[model samples]
Target: MASTHYTPAQLALHWLSAAFIIWALVMGFSVMLLDVTPTFKATIAGVNVSLSILFIPVFAVRTWLRLRHLRDHGHRPGERLAGVIHNVIYAVTALVLVTGVLMMDRPIQVFGWVTLPQPITDPVWDHRFHTLHAGCNGLLGMLVALHVLAVVKHEVVGKPVLRRMWVAR
Candidate 1:
């Protein structure tokens, strides 16, 4: 019988990305909600920014792998909707990363190890990018929720969707 599971590398990337994204999202929200010092807030923001930057390549590889899977295996039942969701997730994620970089006023020091040059210098443009970043994050949040709900629904209904993604063999 043909294998119905993703490769271990794919599963590793999927879980790693999920963990990083969740951490970034939680830190992003915590910075907004907590009454923290500017230094602390900057620290949180720095970590979030670094994670976002790091995620770019990971997302790219994941997308390629997903597309390859689709081409090789063809779409399973109800997978068209999943494909749409995955594409939207990628688009919004890329938008968020771009806007995030543009929203900064100075070079981003990733964990103080490396620095990324600021893309936008004007305050107006930075503000605009910030708005777009926040909006895209909100949309990402909803999409993630839907994705999780669908997974849960499948699991509840005895589908092995999650297993296909989570298990290697």
Candidate 2:
């Protein structure tokens, strides 16, 4: 069976993570592009938080799985570069996720269902964090683009970059 490339579980995680990240980026850009009153801002924050709850757990699990896969860097050295790139991408993602949380200016209310506590109290500091969070998010996007490019480079030019995740052997 050609060594079956990625395990089913690993493939599942890969696709799911891609979908979630794309959705999150879309939602985030939408929220930032449109402005509204504080009430609406709170509503948007609620949506972001709900999605975030899901995003965080998946991210945590993926991180755990990723840590166990250092076996990729066995020989040709591309593995080492890929590992470094992967680490950089994850670090930026963690920054965006965490700073995005700290920058919230309102509480989360699930359409009159539940209210979640606002983590940050001070408005000025929170606003500062908001700027920082947005900046980090931008950096994260760039990293993702670079990651994609690197994958293409490996697959088309150098070696099978994505074969590890997408194929298996």
Candidate 3:
């Protein structure tokens, strides 16, 4: 039998991670496009780093739960494509986060609460990782658009698939 809904914990993590990813993307573009001071840009970078770091464990847990659910309930019709898209999203997200961390030239401070030391300090590698981070984010943006469109398509066709990920009533 296929499960009709995700557990509340899964839904919570899904929505929370989605929100954070959106925010980070927006902030990332803002920093790149706006003529902000170095101080302000650093602040935004800190927030992005902090949020990306936080998302690591969230994604791990969500993946584990999703695998468990799939194991227990089996796949539903049309789920193969959905699963591939989801796995791509996971991979792109991890790539973005990993490259973001690797691109950092200094310690990352989490909203002034905690500080993390840089894992690498080589300028050449940092530049390379920065490029990779930007490229991955571009890919992530497309994947996210596809994801949202798929949900909308499902809804328009009367599937109402969003309810499975939405908070339970």
Candidate 4:
């Protein structure tokens, strides 16, 4: 029998990470559609920095929980297909986030007050990372869509896969 249970920490991390990624994508998309004024760019930069900081703690906890799961359970599922897909999902997600941080070119300010050093300052570096981040985000989005299609197919046509990422659905 397949294991359908995801520990509470795992479920929480799964949804939280998904929500953060979606929020970041929406924010970036929205900001880019506007005219680029200094103040406007600064505002979006601040938001990016704040969200990146939030990513740090959540990713740390998520990684730790994953390590703990591996250490505690020597018996991992032998389902090679799902395991590979999961690894690909995380790799693309992490690449997008790390590159996004590296693409920052200006100081981040909080509501016209305090400022933080730009996460990345070099224009060439920023340009490279920006391209990579966008590319990875696009690739990751497609992969996520495929993953979701697979999950829906499983739920409707076969055994459910989303239960492993959800709260006992």
Q: Which predicted model would earn the best TM-score?
A: 3
lDDT of 4 by residue, 1-169 (tens): 4344668888899898878777776676667767678788767767766776668679778867765765666334666686678778878877877887678777655454566677877799899998998889788878877887888888998776665676756
Q: Rank the candidates by TM-score, best first.
A: 3, 1, 4, 2
Q: Report the C-alpha lDDT of model 2 over 68-87, residue by residue, as the tens digit.
A: 54454233333557568778
Compared with the true structure, all predictions reach lDDT values of 0.82, 0.71, 0.86, 0.74
Candidate 3 regions off by >4 Å? none
**What overall lDDT, based on C-alpha atoms, would model 2 receive against the true structure?**
0.71
Cα shift from native, residue 93, model 4 (Å): 1.5
Candidate 3, 8-88: lDDT as tens digits: 998998998899888888888899989999999988887788888878888889879878987898677668788888888
lDDT of 1 by residue, 6-44 (tens): 888789888997888778877888889888899999888
lDDT (Cα, 0-100) at 104 in candidate 2: 70
Between prediction 1 and prediction 3, the one with superior lDDT is 3
How many backbone clashes does every candidate have? 0, 4, 0, 0
**92 Cα displacement, candidate 3 (Å):** 0.6
> Candidates' TM-scores?
0.89, 0.76, 0.91, 0.77
Clashing pairs in 1: none
Off by over 4 Å in 1: 1-3
